[model samples]
Target: MFRGNKDEVFVRQALEQADYACGRWIASQRHFDVDPTSLLEPLAKAAVVTAVAIYVETARLSQLEVQRALAIETVAQARALIDRLHPLAFGGGWYGGRALR
Candidate 1:
Protein backbone atom coordinates (compact mmCIF):
# COMPACT_ATOMS: atom_id res chain seq x y z
CA MET A 1 0.00 0.00 0.00
CA PHE A 2 2.91 2.34 0.59
CA ARG A 3 3.90 4.17 -2.57
CA GLY A 4 7.36 2.85 -3.36
CA ASN A 5 9.71 -0.09 -3.91
CA LYS A 6 10.23 -0.35 -0.19
CA ASP A 7 7.92 -3.34 0.34
CA GLU A 8 9.12 -5.39 -2.61
CA VAL A 9 11.74 -7.39 -0.79
CA PHE A 10 9.46 -7.92 2.17
CA VAL A 11 6.55 -9.11 0.06
CA ARG A 12 8.73 -11.45 -1.98
CA GLN A 13 10.24 -13.02 1.09
CA ALA A 14 6.82 -13.45 2.66
CA LEU A 15 5.45 -15.19 -0.40
CA GLU A 16 8.41 -17.54 -0.61
CA GLN A 17 8.12 -18.43 3.05
CA ALA A 18 4.37 -18.98 2.78
CA ASP A 19 4.87 -21.32 -0.15
CA TYR A 20 7.56 -23.29 1.62
CA ALA A 21 5.47 -23.59 4.76
CA CYS A 22 2.41 -24.75 2.86
CA GLY A 23 4.52 -27.36 1.13
CA ARG A 24 5.85 -28.61 4.41
CA TRP A 25 2.39 -28.81 5.93
CA ILE A 26 1.12 -30.69 2.93
CA ALA A 27 4.04 -33.08 3.01
CA SER A 28 3.26 -34.12 6.56
CA GLN A 29 -0.43 -34.81 5.79
CA ARG A 30 -0.27 -38.32 4.38
CA HIS A 31 0.76 -41.92 5.19
CA PHE A 32 4.25 -41.27 3.77
CA ASP A 33 6.60 -39.13 5.89
CA VAL A 34 6.52 -38.58 9.63
CA ASP A 35 3.32 -38.77 11.68
CA PRO A 36 0.66 -36.34 10.55
CA THR A 37 0.32 -35.19 14.12
CA SER A 38 3.90 -33.86 13.80
CA LEU A 39 2.59 -30.95 11.73
CA LEU A 40 2.68 -28.90 14.90
CA GLU A 41 6.48 -29.05 14.87
CA PRO A 42 6.81 -27.41 11.46
CA LEU A 43 4.02 -25.00 12.35
CA ALA A 44 5.90 -24.05 15.45
CA LYS A 45 9.06 -23.61 13.43
CA ALA A 46 7.28 -21.29 10.98
CA ALA A 47 5.89 -19.26 13.86
CA VAL A 48 9.35 -18.87 15.34
CA VAL A 49 10.80 -17.86 11.97
CA THR A 50 8.06 -15.28 11.45
CA ALA A 51 8.39 -13.96 14.97
CA VAL A 52 12.15 -13.51 14.71
CA ALA A 53 11.80 -11.77 11.37
CA ILE A 54 9.20 -9.42 12.80
CA TYR A 55 11.36 -8.62 15.82
CA VAL A 56 14.49 -7.90 13.79
CA GLU A 57 12.71 -6.00 11.02
CA THR A 58 10.69 -3.83 13.41
CA ALA A 59 13.89 -2.95 15.29
CA ARG A 60 15.46 -1.86 12.03
CA LEU A 61 12.36 0.09 10.96
CA SER A 62 12.51 2.09 14.16
CA GLN A 63 15.93 3.39 13.18
CA LEU A 64 14.75 4.95 9.90
CA GLU A 65 14.11 8.68 10.62
CA VAL A 66 14.70 11.08 7.78
CA GLN A 67 10.95 11.71 7.51
CA ARG A 68 10.85 12.67 11.18
CA ALA A 69 13.66 15.16 10.71
CA LEU A 70 11.87 16.72 7.77
CA ALA A 71 8.67 17.05 9.80
CA ILE A 72 10.54 18.81 12.62
CA GLU A 73 12.20 21.09 10.12
CA THR A 74 8.81 22.03 8.65
CA VAL A 75 7.45 22.90 12.08
CA ALA A 76 10.50 25.05 12.82
CA GLN A 77 10.05 26.90 9.58
CA ALA A 78 6.41 27.61 10.40
CA ARG A 79 7.38 28.86 13.86
CA ALA A 80 9.88 31.28 12.34
CA LEU A 81 7.19 32.69 10.07
CA ILE A 82 4.79 33.15 12.97
CA ASP A 83 7.47 34.87 15.05
CA ARG A 84 8.20 37.33 12.26
CA LEU A 85 4.58 38.59 12.35
CA HIS A 86 3.99 38.68 16.14
CA PRO A 87 6.81 40.54 17.81
CA LEU A 88 5.57 41.58 21.30
CA ALA A 89 6.03 45.22 22.22
CA PHE A 90 5.57 46.77 25.70
CA GLY A 91 6.64 49.44 28.21
CA GLY A 92 5.77 52.62 26.27
CA GLY A 93 3.44 55.56 26.87
CA TRP A 94 0.32 56.54 24.87
CA TYR A 95 2.55 58.40 22.42
CA GLY A 96 4.02 55.19 21.12
CA GLY A 97 5.15 51.70 22.06
CA ARG A 98 8.70 50.40 21.75
CA ALA A 99 9.04 48.11 18.75
CA LEU A 100 10.17 44.67 19.91
CA ARG A 101 13.80 44.14 18.92
Candidate 2:
Protein backbone atom coordinates (compact mmCIF):
# COMPACT_ATOMS: atom_id res chain seq x y z
CA MET A 1 0.00 0.00 0.00
CA PHE A 2 2.74 2.42 0.88
CA ARG A 3 4.62 1.54 -2.29
CA GLY A 4 1.52 2.10 -4.37
CA ASN A 5 0.94 5.43 -2.71
CA LYS A 6 4.52 6.41 -3.34
CA ASP A 7 4.30 5.42 -6.96
CA GLU A 8 1.13 7.42 -7.37
CA VAL A 9 2.74 10.47 -5.81
CA PHE A 10 5.75 10.13 -8.10
CA VAL A 11 3.56 9.81 -11.16
CA ARG A 12 1.57 12.86 -10.12
CA GLN A 13 4.71 14.90 -9.66
CA ALA A 14 6.14 13.76 -12.99
CA LEU A 15 2.96 14.72 -14.77
CA GLU A 16 2.96 18.12 -13.10
CA GLN A 17 6.52 18.71 -14.24
CA ALA A 18 5.61 17.69 -17.76
CA ASP A 19 2.72 20.13 -17.69
CA TYR A 20 5.01 22.90 -16.55
CA ALA A 21 7.54 22.04 -19.22
CA CYS A 22 4.87 22.14 -21.90
CA GLY A 23 3.76 25.56 -20.73
CA ARG A 24 7.30 26.81 -20.81
CA TRP A 25 7.82 25.34 -24.23
CA ILE A 26 4.74 27.08 -25.56
CA ALA A 27 5.75 30.35 -24.03
CA SER A 28 9.24 30.13 -25.47
CA GLN A 29 8.13 29.08 -28.92
CA ARG A 30 7.97 32.64 -30.18
CA HIS A 31 11.45 33.41 -28.95
CA PHE A 32 12.75 30.20 -30.44
CA ASP A 33 10.85 30.72 -33.70
CA VAL A 34 9.19 27.35 -33.30
CA ASP A 35 5.85 26.66 -34.87
CA PRO A 36 3.41 25.89 -32.10
CA THR A 37 1.41 23.68 -34.40
CA SER A 38 4.32 21.30 -34.79
CA LEU A 39 4.50 20.55 -31.09
CA LEU A 40 0.99 21.14 -29.85
CA GLU A 41 -0.32 17.70 -30.65
CA PRO A 42 2.20 15.83 -28.52
CA LEU A 43 1.82 18.30 -25.73
CA ALA A 44 -1.94 18.01 -25.81
CA LYS A 45 -1.78 14.25 -25.96
CA ALA A 46 0.58 14.12 -23.01
CA ALA A 47 -1.73 16.32 -21.01
CA VAL A 48 -4.74 14.14 -21.78
CA VAL A 49 -2.90 10.92 -20.99
CA THR A 50 -1.52 12.34 -17.80
CA ALA A 51 -4.98 13.38 -16.75
CA VAL A 52 -6.31 9.93 -17.48
CA ALA A 53 -3.56 8.30 -15.47
CA ILE A 54 -4.18 10.63 -12.59
CA TYR A 55 -7.87 9.91 -12.64
CA VAL A 56 -7.27 6.20 -12.79
CA GLU A 57 -4.76 6.21 -9.98
CA THR A 58 -6.97 8.33 -7.79
CA ALA A 59 -10.15 6.44 -8.54
CA ARG A 60 -8.72 2.94 -8.31
CA LEU A 61 -6.22 3.00 -5.54
CA SER A 62 -7.33 -0.41 -4.35
CA GLN A 63 -6.40 -2.04 -7.63
CA LEU A 64 -2.70 -2.40 -7.08
CA GLU A 65 -1.74 -4.18 -10.30
CA VAL A 66 -3.53 -1.82 -12.64
CA GLN A 67 -2.50 1.22 -10.65
CA ARG A 68 1.16 0.24 -10.58
CA ALA A 69 1.32 -0.56 -14.25
CA LEU A 70 -0.46 2.60 -15.25
CA ALA A 71 1.67 4.66 -12.93
CA ILE A 72 4.86 3.18 -14.39
CA GLU A 73 3.66 3.69 -17.94
CA THR A 74 2.53 7.24 -17.26
CA VAL A 75 5.79 8.16 -15.57
CA ALA A 76 7.76 6.74 -18.45
CA GLN A 77 5.70 8.73 -20.92
CA ALA A 78 5.99 11.90 -18.89
CA ARG A 79 9.73 11.46 -18.46
CA ALA A 80 10.20 10.94 -22.16
CA LEU A 81 8.26 14.09 -22.93
CA ILE A 82 10.15 16.00 -20.32
CA ASP A 83 13.47 14.81 -21.68
CA ARG A 84 12.45 15.93 -25.15
CA LEU A 85 11.07 19.27 -24.04
CA HIS A 86 13.51 20.25 -21.31
CA PRO A 87 16.18 21.66 -23.55
CA LEU A 88 13.67 23.30 -25.87
CA ALA A 89 11.78 24.85 -23.02
CA PHE A 90 14.61 25.70 -20.63
CA GLY A 91 17.49 26.09 -23.11
CA GLY A 92 20.18 24.89 -20.78
CA GLY A 93 22.03 22.27 -22.82
CA TRP A 94 21.67 19.48 -25.33
CA TYR A 95 19.25 16.65 -24.58
CA GLY A 96 18.93 13.34 -26.39
CA GLY A 97 21.52 14.43 -28.98
CA ARG A 98 19.44 17.45 -30.02
CA ALA A 99 20.99 20.85 -29.61
CA LEU A 100 17.88 22.66 -28.40
CA ARG A 101 19.84 25.49 -26.87
Return the top candidate by lDDT.
2
* lDDT agreement with native, every candidate: 0.39, 0.45
lDDT of 2 by residue, 1-101 (tens): 35658877987686566654675654343432444323334444444345434434544322443333343333344445445444433455643443322
Question: Candidate 1 local accuracy as lDDT?
Answer: 0.39
lDDT of 1 by residue, 1-101 (tens): 56687687787776566765675554332322344333234443343334334433543422223232223223233233223322322235423654333
TM-score of 2: 0.26
Steric clash count of candidate 1 = 0
* Candidate 1 Cα errors over 4 Å, as ranges: 1-40, 61-101
Top candidate (TM-score): 2
